[model samples]
Target chain A: MKRVKKWAAAITVFITGFIFLIPFYIMFYLSLSSPGDSIAEEWFPRALMVQNFREAWEKASMGRAMVNSLVITVGAVLLLVFCAACGGYGAARVKNKINRMIFYIMVLSMMVPGIINTVPLYIMMRRINGINTYWGMIMLLACQSLPFSVFLYESFIRTMNSSLEEAAIMDGCTRFEAFWRIVFPLLKPITATVVIMQGVGIWNNYAQSVFFLQNQNYHTIPLAISTFFRPMELIIICLPPGRQLVLRLLQWFF
Target chain B: MMAPAAVLFLVFFVLPLCQGVGISMTDWNGFSEEKNFVGFANFIRFFSDKRALHAIQVTVVFGLVSPFLLNVSGLFLALLVDSKRKSRVLLRMIIYLPSIISPLIMGYLWTLILSPRTGVLDQILQRFNPSLSFDWMGVPDKALWLIIMVNVWQFTGGPMMVYLAGLQSIPKDLYESAKIDGAGRMQAFKNITWPLLYPSAKINIFNNIIGSMAVFDIIMAITMGGPGYATESLSIYIYRQSFNGFAGYATAIALIMFLIIAVPIGITMRWMKNKEIEM
Candidate 1:
């Protein structure tokens, strides 16, 4: 009975793994197949065509698009980290009624639909010359990410003891300086979580970017890819170069 | 000092939110220079419009159903891959890889696979059984389920990870003790894992409810709310109405959606938080 059970477990794992991999297999197979390679007839990459990658890159202006996306993502992540880290510290240490209220408001806003902010935000962006600018996109994304980022940072900081920063304050450091010099370096773990979570969303942002960034020159990757209905371009972007996805995910697990 | 952060949040989020509330009260044509206030009229119009009501129904239905499916499947998959075997790592990654693709792209991917006559899926089905053919994606009911299925597919990674964390945090000693006591597998799972897993379930349920309710990009790419507005969600309706010269009315719909999302999430969260403490 135990042997049969072990066999059952192994088979279930194997079959489910294969079933789960089929969509991705289709992605690889379709993206690499030539025009003549029929998807219905063939289940694998028959043509092994690398030419589509070149075509997608050149035709889509992906180099420029990637740079645009990178700038927006990196910029937003930086601004969000700075603001959220400080805001989190302020929320944690201050323990004031107004601070708690602001923190709760931030948390609640996460449930508010992006649609609610779309029309007026566009009008506001237009007024401030923010409509097609990189800084403008960065500011908007960082703001969208701030609430959750601050919430994470605040919770992470609560688990920490504040004696180190308190000692810095006693040694003639201002509150801000104490936070900067003593406490900021210790926020690596939560900061990484913030970067991974918010960075992915910012890189893949579409709803607001569709409105605020209509100009082609300033287009990010998702915006650029949306113009063409090719899965080849998308799968290409989803796979980061030189890293297996298993490697990428295992870090989060182990 | 979160001064810069506060300034950005105020300028970007709070200001626009206030402006959005203001816009919902007016009869401003999207591009018109002149605007007139029409308080509560748009809100009243939403109730009278049948399309709006159907959208509300569609949104609420999708919101409620998809979350249940996602959490169940997520926890199940989490349990399946929660072994000590090395291949477990690979299985987990395969399940999660699709989620790395944006939902908009996933919609397009599914569309390319399932488009009516020319799609790969149709072609494959035709080859397998020449007489078997149907338009499931084109039908209203099937399309809603299809979108929910796709939503679950693309997003189950998040909940899976959460549940896996929860499962791991559960020490193996309890299971060993239960085994020694001759507890059946089902009984052990029911009495131990299920109760201990509530926190993860709570998080997954809460996130999925709001996320599925506010779903937009996938449905936009999939059906574009077609077949006579059968699948048009509240979010999609807000977008369409906004651009089609009913900016104020659109904002009103969006605010309604906010209430729809906020009130339930708030109540459920409180209820779950209390239950979690009790557990």
Candidate 2:
């Protein structure tokens, strides 16, 4: 009975793993196939050529898009992390009603759908001349991701002892300096989690990129990839610089 | 210190929400300077309009199904890979690989695989049974299920990781003590594991519910709410409306969706908090 159960578990895990990998395999195979050779026509490619990727990249102006995406993602992640860390620290350490209210409001904001904010945000962006600007996209994306990060940072920071910062403050360090030197460094683990989550969130974002970035010159990877629905473009869009970052994060988890 | 986040929240989040509430009552096409106030008209129309109503039904069905499916699968996978065996590490990576990529990419990939004539699945099916080509997204019901299944596939990894993290924090000594009492595996799981996992369960389930309801990228890429608005979620409908020059109407629909998600989630979170306290 025990032997049968062990085999059953192994087989189940193996089959499910295979099923999970099917789309990744198909996308990779289709990416490697030549353009004129229809992917659906044959299961395997006649020739494995990586030239299609280069063609797809040039056709989509992906170099510009990749740079734009990287800028936006990095900017958004930095702004989000800084503001969320401060707000989370305040809410976690401060015991006042206003702080608690702010924390709860931020938490409630998570339940608000992004679609609801689309029209008004567009109007506001146009009014403020924020359309097609990196700061415009970064601010909104940062705000969108802020609540979750604040929640994560708040919880993680709450678990940490307050004595370290107190001792630093007593040693002639200003409160800001104490927090900068002590509290912030201790938040490395949760900061990593925030970076990984928000990195992917900003990197792979589609609707905001398409909506906010009307100029083709300023298009992010998702926007450019969405414009052309080719298999080659799909492969290009799937592998961003953040892909390596996320893979590294998963490695750290083990 | 909180000023920046507070300012951002007011500008991007709170301000827009307030503006959306006001815009929903107007007859403002996106480009027009004239904003005619037509109070309650759009909301009433949302209830009466067939496409809007169908989108609501689709959204609700998706909300009901995908969360349950994704969480169950995630928990199962988490349990499977939680073992201390070396092979489990590879299994974790494979299971999570899809989720690490963009859902838009996954949706487009599936679109190619599920196309009636040119899809890989159809091509494979054609080899065995010549008359068995299937249009996975052509039919209304099937399209809904297909999007839901695809969403489940892409999103399960997130909750799986959450559960795995939760499981790791659980003290092994409890299980050891239970074993000393001659408690069986099933009993120990029921008495300890399930109860202790509630916190993770709450977070995972809540996240899944929100994600499934606000599902836009996958459906937009795969079906584009096609086959006559069959798989249109509220977000997709709102997207169509806004791009089609009904920005006011779209905002109105978006507000309704906001209420639909917010009220229930809030109540459930409160209820779960109470339950946690009781436990």
Candidate 3:
């Protein structure tokens, strides 16, 4: 009975895992197929050309795009963490009417769908000369990410012991200084979680990037990959699975 | 301490939202400063627009169905992993692989798979029975269904992770206690696990509601709301309308979309307030 149960569990996991990876399997299969090989015609690669990886890598400008994504992601995450952590801490500890109201408003703002803000945001970005600039994109991404991060930080901080922070404040440290020196350092775990979640989001941002970062030079990986989104175009898109894998791998490391 | 977030929320979020409401009431072409307030005219036009109404239908269907599917599947996977105990690390990673990349990329990747003759899925299905082969995204009837399934497939990892955390936090003693009292597996699960999983359920339900309802990039990448705009979500509708010189109409549509999402969210928040589900 025990043996039967073990085999059943293993097989179930195997099947689920295979289902999860079907897209990836298809991705790798097509990426290696020669240009002459038609995905419509071929079940597998007709000619295995490892050279396609290199060809697609250079063709897609993956390196420059990677750098753009990394810089933007790192900057945005740092800014979001700094601002949201403080906001969350304040919301959790201060408990004043203004702070409470602000917290509620921010939480409520999370439901305002992206499209609502896009038109005005685009106009504003152009007016402020923010289009195609790294800082502008970073600031925008950080703000798009702010409400959730603040909510997370607030809920998380509320669960922690406040007496230590209170003692720090009582010992002549200003509230800000106490939070910075004491509570901020201990936020490492939640900060890491925030960084991973928000970093993936910021790195993979497409909607705003397509609108805000339209310049060819400023395109991130996602924006770069969209070059092949044209109709009747699969081979050009599929061949660049190298960068997509890099995205998943980057996610894995985090 | 609240200064930075307060500033960001006010300037970026609150300000844009206020500007958005103002824009919804106007005739601005989204660029020219010249404008006129035409209150509720755009809103009236939405009921007349067949495509906009279709989008509301699609959005509500997608919104309602995806959360149910994701929550159920996530909990299922979480239980499977929790039962095994030793192999979860790798299993969790493998399951979560779909969610890491941008939905735009996911959409593009699906296009590669679901494309007509030259698509991977079509070729594979052709080999199997030939009759099984069909254009998945081309047909209007199947496209929205495909979008919802893809949405569920992509983000199931997030809910699964949450459920796994909730499952692990559950004390073994509860199960042991139930077993001691001669409860069957179903009874134990119903009486204990289901109630205990409320917090995780609430969070998952909330996230899935928002994520699936606001879905854009994937659908945009996959169908671009195409095959006669059959799969055009509210987000896509707003995008096309705004750029096509109906900026005021689009903002009005956006506000309607907000109300659609807000009602469910308000209900959930109230429910959360009342329950106060204890761990």
Candidate 4:
């Protein structure tokens, strides 16, 4: 019975790992398979080809998309970090009702779904002629990402000792100087958490980019990849037999 | 210092939420100048709309299944990697790579793999066993399940990292004590590990649940709630209503979804706070 339980646990772990990996395996295979491989019934690619990556890269305007994604993601992350750092410092040190209210408000802001305001946000963007502009997208992404950033930072701040701030002040540091010089530096671990979490969140975002950025030239990686699906489907509709077999084999192996 | 954050939050977050509510009560077509107060009509329409209701059902199913599976699987992975391991950092990185990719890209990538014909997945299944044939995303019933599978794949990494942090915080002495008491691995896990990991479990479940409830990109990219609305969630329904020209009604649906999620979330927070105290 004990041996059986151990086997069950081991098998569960293995299956979980397999589940995590299967899509990646599929993606590798799909990326390697040629466009004309039309055989619908096989799993492994018979031929290994790098053409799909090249094709996907060029057709998706990957370079420009990467730049756009990077600009938006990095800009948003920096803005969030700066704003949250300041806000977190103020909320941590100030005991006023207003600061408490501000903290709760930030928490509440997180629950508001992005799609709820997307329509008005688009209209607002258009009015400002900010549509498809990197700044506009960055501002929107920053606003959406700020609540969690502030929350994480505020929690970390609450756990910190206040003596550092007192010492900095005794050494003639102003409140702002104390926060910037002492508090901000102390937030490295939490900052790492915030950066990783928000960076990944903003970088991987697609819905906001899709709605706000209509210019084809301003497309992000996600938008570019999405455009590949239909065209690939269209190409698969036209392949001949023997080459199709090669395509199927390519699909399976990669 | 709080002024800037407060102003931004009020303008971008608070006001928009109010506007979202106000928008739901009006008969404003997205681009039109003319508008009228529709009151409860939009809400009435949403509740009665068959397609919208189906989407809500699908969204609820996805929310329930995906969070549970992802959290459990993540905990399992965290436990495996946490126990008696070297190269754990490399293993963690490998597992987390997918979480960094945009869900939209992942969805697009998966659509290719799960394609009915010429998909790598279909080809591989055929190679191993001739009778094992399936169009993973082509069928409506299967499409919803496929979306759930994709979500689990993408999000398990985040929770896994959190769980790893939690596992590392557990003292080595507890396990040693369990072993001295004749406890085997399972016994040690149940007696020592499980009780101590409750806090991590709560946080992981809370984060994933809230996150999963707002799932939009993956569904949009992969199936577009398609093979006929099989994978539609509340967020997708709102997108369809908003962009697809059901403006006020879309806001109404959004409001409903907000309520559905918000009330339960508020309750969960309260419950978890109390549970934390108890622990």
Candidate 5:
């Protein structure tokens, strides 16, 4: 009976993993095959070609998009981590009623959707002449992501003991120095988790990029892939029947 | 130090939410020079609109079904791979890979695979059964299901990891004790594992529901609520109303969605808090 259960569990894992991998397998096969070859009955590519990838890279401006995405993600993560670390430390250490009030207000921010502010944020960006700018996009993402960062940091900081701070104080360090020297170092794991979570999220984001940065120069990878479906003269000349159908479906949806 | 973070949240989140509620009560077109308070007329319009109602229903269905299916499947997957198997790490990586792919890219990639004319699925189906041509995105019946399937594929990995963490935390001694007491595998799971996993279940359910409700980019890329309003969700509907020149109506729908999400979330959080205390 135990053996039977183990076999069943193994089979379940295999089946679930296969289902999860199907789309990725299809993507890999399609990316390798020529546009015409992808429509063939063969699941594996008959004639492997790198031309599609090369063309996609150039036409989509993926190289530039990668850099733009990286910059935005890193910038937002830095700002979020720095601010959240300081704020969370303050909230944990400071005993004032004002600090408690501030902490609750930050927690409330997590409930509201960022989309609610889109129109006003757009207008503000325009007034500041920041539309289509990288800084504008970074700042917007930072604002949206700050709430979760502060929440995570605060929870982690509360778990930490205050003896480290006391030791630093006995060593003649100032309060700010004590926090910077004692608390921040211990918070690295939480910061790493925050960076990974928000980094991946910001990197894949499309809405803010599409709405804020209209210029081709500032297009992130998601937005660049979107532009591939736009009116491009090369598409008519190069795309096969199957690829054209895919493009049409995307255009209809978008 | 907390001052800057607090101010940013208030300015961006609290003020905007308050302003949105105000806008929902008014007959504002988002860009008009004149605005007037309509006093719950927008809410009334939201309830009366058939399309909006359909979108709401779709959103609720997706919210419930996708998370339930994903969490169940994820928990099962985690349990399966929890044993000391050589392929466990490989299986885990393969399962989690989809979470890393951008939804827009995934949407585009799936379109290539699901296209009726040249899609791989069509070709495979044709080989086994020649008369199996079906319009996946074009037909209203299959479009929403397809979207749900895509979401499940993308998100199961995250919940699987959470469940894996919970599973690891359960002491092996408990399982050994259950076995010594003549408890079968199923009985042991029922007696020992299930109770211990409740916290993880609560968290996974809450996260998946909230995350799924906010789903926008994938649907925008895949279906756009096509073949009529079959796949229309609240978020998509809100986008249509606001950016698609129905600002007054859109604000109303947004408020309705906010309520729908908030009330259920609040209730669940409260219930989970109680459960946490009991545990």
Candidate 6:
């Protein structure tokens, strides 16, 4: 009876895993087949034509959109990492009423639903001519995601040994130099986590991209793909690159 | 050091939130040279507006249903994968594969799968039931369910990981003692597993409820809250209102959503904190 139950459990798990994977397989199969050549219902195409990827890339102007996405993501991640690290270090090291208040406020206010800020932010972007600008969108996104990043950085930094930095300072290294030379390098693991999290957050972001990037030229990958209904484009962008990025990100948490 | 982070937070989040409150008091078109304040008019209009009320109704349902279902499934999957088996890691990764894709893309893919005519599902079903057709994206409730299903699908992975970790952290000695006490599997689980899993459950449930309540990208990509606002979540409603040149009304709706979401989350968190303290 026990053996039978274990087999049933294994089969159930296998079936669930298979079901979860079917959509990805279907997406991949669709991407490989030439458009208008066959029915999408087929489990597999008889002929595997790969030319659709290049055509889809050009037709959607995916290159420009990709470049725009890369710029925003890299810019936002860098700014977020640096600023969050600094703020986190201060919050961790400094013991003052004001600092404690700021830390608590940030952690609590992180629960504010993001959509509530959209209308006013839209207006602010327009008033400041931030619409369609990379820095404008990047800055807004960085700030939107800042509270959690600061929380994570502060908690992570607090657990690490601070004696090394104190020793460095005692040896006459300036504060900035001590942090840059001795302390920051130890933050590599948390830094990677931040990068993966923020990287995926920026790459897969559509709401802000749609709201701010009214011009087609400024569209991010997810935004561009959603606005334009091209299967090949969807697969090319969402399949390989997206899957790898997410897998890497999920690894950190696991 | 904190100046940059604080300045960004102030300029983007704090200031916009305050300004949103001010804007909600007016009847300003989203963009115009002239503006006049009409205090509480938009809020009053929200109470009487049928579409806004319908959106609230739908959002509440979506928020409640999706989070509940996601957590249940997440915990189930976590248990299934927690067995001491060789393929567990691969199985876990495969189950989580769908979550990594943007919900926008997932919604788009689901629309194709759920399409009535040329959709993969319908096409497969046609062979067995030639007269059968499913128009999930067109119907009101079905579209809502579809949106909810997609949300659950994309979000279950994170919670599953959380629960798996929670399960692992549970000391084996408790379970061993329960087994030695001649407890059945069900009895052992009831006594040992469920109570110990509360912390993970608390975190997962709270996150899921908040995240699913603000669901926008999936709804927008799939049906655009269309077929007469059938699947119009509050976030979508806000998006539409703002774009249709009713920034004040949109802000009013957003504020309502914020209060509804925030108050419950805050209360539940406090209650949970107390529960943790008691235990």
- Quote the positional error of residue B262 for candidate 5 in Å: 1.3
**Which pairs clash in model 3?**
A40-B118
Ranking by DockQ: 3, 6, 2, 5, 1, 4
| Candidate 1 lDDT, A1-254, residue by residue in tens | 99999999889889977866765555566667666665778777575766656666766677787889889999999999999999999889988887787788888888886777888888888889999999999999999989989999999989899999999899999999998877889999999999988888888788878888989999887777666543533443454211122211211222
Instruction: Chain B TM-score per candidate, please.
Output: 0.95, 0.96, 0.95, 0.93, 0.94, 0.95
Candidate 2, residue A139: Cα displacement in angstroms equals 0.7
Docking class of 3: medium
Off by over 4 Å in 5: A1-7, A230-254, B277-279
Tens-digit lDDT string for candidate 6 (B1-279) = 577888888898989999999999988888897677999999999999999888888888988898789889999999999977778888898888767667877877776667666566776777668898778877876888888887888779889999999999988988888888899989988877887888998988787878878889888867888779888889999988899999998999999998778866877788788656223
Over B36-56, each residue of candidate 1 has an lDDT whose tens digit, in order, gives: 999999999999999999999
Tens digits of per-residue lDDT for model 4, B1-279: 777677767766777677777878987778777778988999988878899889778877887789899988898789777765445555676678778777776776676667765565677678778787778687888888889988888778889988888889888997888888899999888877877877887888777777778889888878888877778888888777788776777778877887777865677778777556223
**What TM-score, computed on C-alpha atoms, does each candidate reach?**
0.92, 0.92, 0.93, 0.89, 0.91, 0.92
For model 4, the superposed segments whose C-alpha errors exceed 4 Å read: A1-19, A35-48, A230-232, A238-254, B178-188, B277-279
In the range B38-106, model 5's lDDT, one tens digit per residue, is 989999987788998898888888888898899998998898777666788789878887786677767
DockQ per candidate? 0.41, 0.45, 0.59, 0.40, 0.44, 0.47
lDDT of 4 at B207: 76
**C-alpha-based local distance difference test score of model 3:** 0.82
Ranking of predictions according to TM-score: 3, 2, 1, 6, 5, 4
Q: Which has the higher TM-score value, candidate number 2 or candidate number 5?
A: 2
DockQ pick, better of 2 and 3: 3
Q: What is the lDDT of residue B207 in candidate 3?
A: 84
lDDT of each residue in A112-220, candidate 3, tens digit only: 7666788778877788899999998998999999999999999999999999988988899999999999999999998998998988888888878877898989988
Candidate achieving higher TM-score, 3 or 4: 3
